[model samples]
Target chain A: MMYSPAIIAEAVVNGLMTGAVYALIALGLTLVYGVLHIINFAHGALLTAAMFAVWAVYVAFGLDPYLAILPLTPLFFGLGYAVQRFVIGPASHGSDSNILLVTLGLSIAIENALLAGFRSDTRTLNTDYGFQVVELGPLLLSKPRLIGFGAAVLVTVLLWLLLSRTDTGKAIRAVAKEKLGASLVGIDVAHVYAVTFGLGCACLAVAACLLMPTFYVNPRIGQAFVLVAFTIVVLGGMGSIPGALVGGLFIGVVESLCGLFLGDSLGQIGIFLIFILVLLVRPTGLFGAKA
Target chain B: MLEVRSLRAGYGGTEVLRGLDLSVGAGEIVAVLGSNGVGKTTLNKVLSGVLRANEGEIRFDGKTLTGASSADIVEAGLIHVPEGRKIFPNMSVRENLELGSYRRGRERRSANLERVFETFPRLRERSGQAAGTLSGGEQQMLAIGRGMMAEPRLLILDEPSLGLSPLLVEEMFTLIRRLNGEGLPILLVEQNVVQSLECASRAYILENGLFALSGTAEQVRNDPELKRAYLGM
Candidate 1:
């Protein structure tokens, strides 16, 4: 393949944009893991569901795609809270594997349900910004990609502040580190778990809405992103927020580079190869502590 | 300030605390001494609302706390410093201390932080260090300092002396006595019988989920049975 300077610049720009979106996705996964100590396997499916919900609102009510997220976030937040309280909570009683199994089942059920309700047909948001592109010297950026990237960064910063500065955030971190000690200090572990799960789902809802203009959505699309998100979570360290952010961006750039230098299919294979290598070399991930 | 009556609790069909009773009065230090696996930690768990008691009544400041949540218990001013010095490992010493007052001590956070720093000058000196990196003795101080940040009415210290050097252990006991002297009621749970008895006003010995001995520390210390079993005298 002949390499062009313009193409390389475009690839790098695209990698960063896509990396932001991936970080948004992985942030929720990492947050839930950090506080709740469970792998929320259904996280990707929840994102898919949110995407479909946004599409449904757009189709039924003719609401703007961005406007749809306003109502969708709280709706999904409540749903996430309920899911943690009822389904996930019970499964969390025993071994960690129990919660894993339950969430996996939830993922399967959600994907199939979306498939039945919305069909397997692909969908995209019709927005003025969807197809628009802006030029910045040698690099060109899509409007939606720019907006999504901005939103991702904003959300990541907001979450970081919340976890580090606020009382609730500290409570959540305490629960993540030591549930027994948290309870001893009068931190409500159950409430923190519910809120953390809700927060994670809310992040997904936002990511899904932002993602609409940039990518096509379908019932099975979550299957495509789930593995990638998990890979990001694992690579970033299981429960580290900063790790997730850096890991997501790194993966995004790596994928872009692979696609540019290698074939597209080989790019994905290369990403997985990186996952395997990371597992062998730094099992705790780049930022993960030895728990 | 606190009383646990007929407390019974367990995990996975195995009962850990079976019909236990204990109490701590205002400005007093009550030590709970026991061998490992005899439910010293379990008593703390039940009293602190970390574990739900199967049958018992826990009264704190005349409030029923048996089934209350841990946050509620903390809000009620009953704080528990758990075993193994469960400080937030990744957080800075200051952040860990700040979180201690998370539920009910938010308003007095800064003042309490100052008080904790004064008490454990080492913590103040290394307030920005990650708690996990602290030495075992320093971690124990951080744990107690965090507990103090909550402005607890009745603080429960569970095996505070565990994993400490003999010198640090003495220092920890002295700190506990100092805190008690400052008019805070405390429940000190430990395996170090002699020091615990020396520091506590009253003492309880737990064995097989029940009180094996209970009296003033002096009386309990002088008892022939306790001396033989615990002191190897």
Candidate 2:
């Protein structure tokens, strides 16, 4: 197929922006998986729930979407902690599959609850900046996309620093490696698990708030992003923060290029094809170690 | 000082350590020796708070530690280097050592890191390398070094010699002796009866979840039953 320079440039920019959001979504799932050893299938539904929460706050109080995140994060953090402590913790029992089932059940329960509560209507955050666009040479960048990308990068960087440099971060890493050994070294494994899940949910909180301005929200919308996030998490290596960042961006660029060169349907299939290829080449992903 | 009385523990319905009693004096190197499946590791697990006792009293430095959380137990300076290395395979050697002091050693993390490096200089040279890549001997040294980073008053090592080369096994014994020389008490759990008895001041022989024999290392070493059962002499 013949490719125009303008089309390629637009595709690249679009992919980068979409990839940023995917990174944010994957960040939490990977973190939870690293420490808790659970796939956390409900993670996508949680993001959708957070989006709806933000939407409710914005539509009711006329608050800025960004400001809604401030209160929303701590709220979701508490929700995540409780979910782990009360629901997920008992079921875990050192079984990986059990946790997966629990999370999958949670995903279904959450999506259906949202469907029952809000119906299947697509709702977008109608901020003034939502429609605003910036033109640089032949490329057009939406204001919301730019802001979402920035927020995703900022949050991911902050999480990386937290996991690498902080005391709590050390404890989280310890538990991830060896729960019994971490306990022997005086880390509360249960507390670490709860807090890690909370932090992961907090990422979704930020992603949901920032993304509302860029995309429409509905009960089933979580599936669209969750699949991409899972692919990024696996591609980046399960627990590697930097890997997630690079993987997200890489997937975004590929998706954008594919959409431009191939059709949209083919582009998604191409993304999955890449996911399978990465798994075959390196099961641990780019940064992950073997399980 | 560490004292465990009537400590009862097991996995799922099968009691591995049934009302076991043991004590280790300050600055003493005591070994718990037994053949495979005698619950030597189970005793370490109960002592380190990794497994809760079904019934018993555990006192460390006169503080009742029964049912206490593992983190609290570690904070109290009771550290356990588990049976397997259990090191964070993905983390660098330095990171694994640094994590050793996550609870109570946070203040002296750098200092303790240096001390561990001194104890296992090879780890210092490969501080940035992933721990899983280390040779078995080096991994054993890393495990011991990680335990040292906690500044443990009473260290429990569960099979530090397991899967080590003959030369490394000798080195492991020497390292235990050196750590004991520094006034650090150790509870060495092992199936290598003869070697463990050589380094320990006191030795306890466990059989079927009970202490079959207990005395000074010399006395336990010369026990005819132990020699017949374990040494195959």
Candidate 3:
């Protein structure tokens, strides 16, 4: 079966758009990993919770998902900070395995709680912009997805500025590199940990808002995105911001092409195959600092 | 001025610093010299709030900091340049220095940065380079420069000369002396006994987690046990 150039272009465009969203999902994971050095198993659950938050507000008050980002971003940030400060940081006690187990346990608890509250039903925002599309040359891109792409990139740029240009961001990088040194300089280490986690969650909140309009959410929806996110984090280099963004887009294109050629289920395998290959060939990741 | 009373600290079941009392008066350079395994680094840790005291009191500038957090201790202007030159390897030299004022010197960060650059002209030259890429001596200079950025009321330097070459070690001692000449009280913790006593106004020789001998530099340097154990007289 031969596909037309138009179809291929559309597929690539779709992948890029989706990849931008994936980058948003990954920004948080990369930031958390860069500082905390832990694979937050609960990241997906947090996404699901943020999606539900957006969904709940939309359903109850008719607030737009786009608008929900304003309130939800900071709310999720606070939530993430509290989780790290109160739950994860204290419970893990600075041990790697303990952090892993605690996050894993938190993931299970959150998923179950969401499963109970919202049940297994898939909820999506049926906004007026839901069916809108923009015509660009021969390709028709979904308006919401385009917004998501621009917004994700914008947020990433903003995050880069925060890290490179601000005091809090410098403190975060310092803590990421040297925790004891960061404290010796008077940065509250616990506070910086919470802030980094909060920023990670805030990224997820924005991603959740972007995804809610074009996508549906259930207790398990975030699991799917997070699996791809983990692949991107590894592919891009664990702690590199640009790596996450580009890795997300690269994986997005790869997944899209794989779906077009190998079918949907196998397309998922394409992601993991690349994940393994990257691990084997370039264990430091594309942007990871050389050990 | 900084004062520690019967400071007792250690890791797990083994005590590293056992019931040691020490102090640094204002405008004084006090050296705490010891050999390996004698709790030099451990005492620095306890004073810097990286480790807790098993039993004792730490009062910095009249504020009891026995239970204070690292940030609180720093806010009190008791800055510690830890052993091993724990500079953020991946960050730029300027960034590592900028982070020195994360707690205490925010308003004067730029000014302190300029002063650091002036003090360490080599740092200014390699300001944009990653710290890990710097030579060993340069990294030590960066570490001390970082501590200076904190506007330290009392600066504590731990093994600042550990890995430097002999010539660089001489420079390190000179820089320590110069910093002391500026009216800053310093607690110089080192294994370099001879130079430490030479550089400090007062000296405390640590042994078995206690101060075995302490007095003015001349007295401690002339002590028979110090000469026998450290100088191999």
Candidate 4:
């Protein structure tokens, strides 16, 4: 197949746009992994819940998805915090497998609850301005994708600043690096874990809102996207923020190019190939420090 | 300032600090010395609330601390500078020190940080560097400095001199003495028999999870059994 330069450039741009949302989803996953040392298989389910919650708000109050961010994000943050404190915190002291089982159980329960409540119907946000396009010389950028990408970059930079500059952020990172060391220095590690989980959920809330315009939400939406998020997390190196961004973009481009050149089904295959290659060649991921 | 009575603790079924009794008075430096795996570190872990005591009572600054969360223990100012220099490897020296005051000394954090820097000039010089990147001796200092940041009422130094050079060991002992001279009570748990005895006002020899010997530093240092086993005197 002969591809023109314009098509290639369009694929690259499309890849970056989708990659931004992927990074948003994976950031929470990696943050939880870093501090709690748990894989948080339920993270995707949590995002699905956030998507439904935002949709509910939009439907009930006729609020824009972007405006719903203010209320839904904080509410989900609290929900995440409570879940960690009351639910995950107890199992966290057990073996890694214990947390794994617990989170997996939670994921199943959440998906079923959504299925029971919302049925298997696909919910889409009917926004007025979603299809509007912004042109940058040769490239036509969809308004929703541009906004999602901007929000992703903004959140990532803000999270980086929070982790590097603030005392609470330092405490979270400290707990992530060394639990005993954190406690020794008077850090309430249990509390940090809960907050980190909450923060992770908050990121999901933001990602859910940004994604509402373009993505269709269903009970099993998490299952569809979470696998891709995991790929991004590993590709970006387990706890590195910048790695998540770059990894997302790489996966995005691969998906777009493969879909364009081969077929839609082959794009999914291409993603797995890259995942396997990264695992085989550099198990630590791109930015992961030597374990 | 610190007391433990009938302390029975261990990893799981095997008891490490079995029915042990010990105490540290205010403005005193007490050392608990033993060879590796003799439960010196275990005692620190139990005291710091990391390991649960099967049956015992621990009183710190007139309040019972047994079974308290590590956070509450540190909040009460009984800081444990754990063995192996467990500084946050990914954090800068400054951040490591700052976290020391996270619970107890948030108000005077800057002041305490300056004091810690003054105490360990090397840590101050490398304040921006990651704790993991520091040399062994520097890491040890950072550990102790991080401990000091909490304004500990009674500092517990667990094997501070472990993996240090001979000269650095001497320097560590001297630093311990200097810290103690400031009227801060310290519970020094170590395998270095001689230096610990020299710096500590009193010493206890732990063996097989029990205190085999206890006396003034001089008495424990000159004990025939101790000399035969530890120093080969």
Best by lDDT: 3
Q: What is the C-alpha RMSD of each candidate to the true structure, in Å?
A: 1.8, 2.1, 1.2, 1.7
- As for candidate 3, its clashing pairs are none
Give residue A86's error in model 2 in angstroms.
2.0
iRMSD (1 decimal) for each model: 1.1, 1.3, 0.9, 1.0
List chain A TM-scores, every candidate, in order. Answer: 0.95, 0.95, 0.97, 0.97
lDDT of 3 by residue, A43-131 (tens): 99999999999999999999899999999999999999999999999999789999999999999999999999989998777899998
For model 3, the stretches where C-alpha displacement exceeds 4 angstroms are none
lDDT of 2 by residue, A1-291 (tens): 887888788889989998998899889989998888778899989999999998999989998898887899999999999999889889778678988898999999999999999999999888888889989789999888888899899999989898888878877987887777677778888889999999989999999988898788999988888899899999999988888888999899998888777888778776799899998899899998767
Candidate 1 regions with alpha-carbon error over 4 angstroms: A263-267
Candidate 1 residue-wise lDDT, A1-291, digit = tens: 788989887887887888888888899999998877788889989999988988888889988777877898899889998898888887678468888999999999999999899888998877777889989888888888888888888989998999889888988888888777777777777778888999999988888888887788999887677688788889999998888888888888888889989978777776698899989999999899886
Q: What is the lDDT of candidate 4?
A: 0.90
Comparing 1 with 4 on TM-score, the higher-scoring candidate is 4
How many residue pairs clash in all the candidates, one count each? Answer: 2, 1, 0, 0
Candidate 2 chain B minimal-lDDT segment of 10 residues: B84-93
- Every model's TM-score: 0.95, 0.94, 0.98, 0.96
What TM-score does chain B of candidate 2 reach? 0.98
Task: Compute the lDDT of residue A129 as modeled in candidate 3.
Answer: 90
Q: Which candidate order results from sorting by TM-score in descending order?
A: 3, 4, 1, 2
Provide DockQ values for all models, in the order shown.
0.74, 0.69, 0.84, 0.78
Q: Which candidate is the best by DockQ?
A: 3
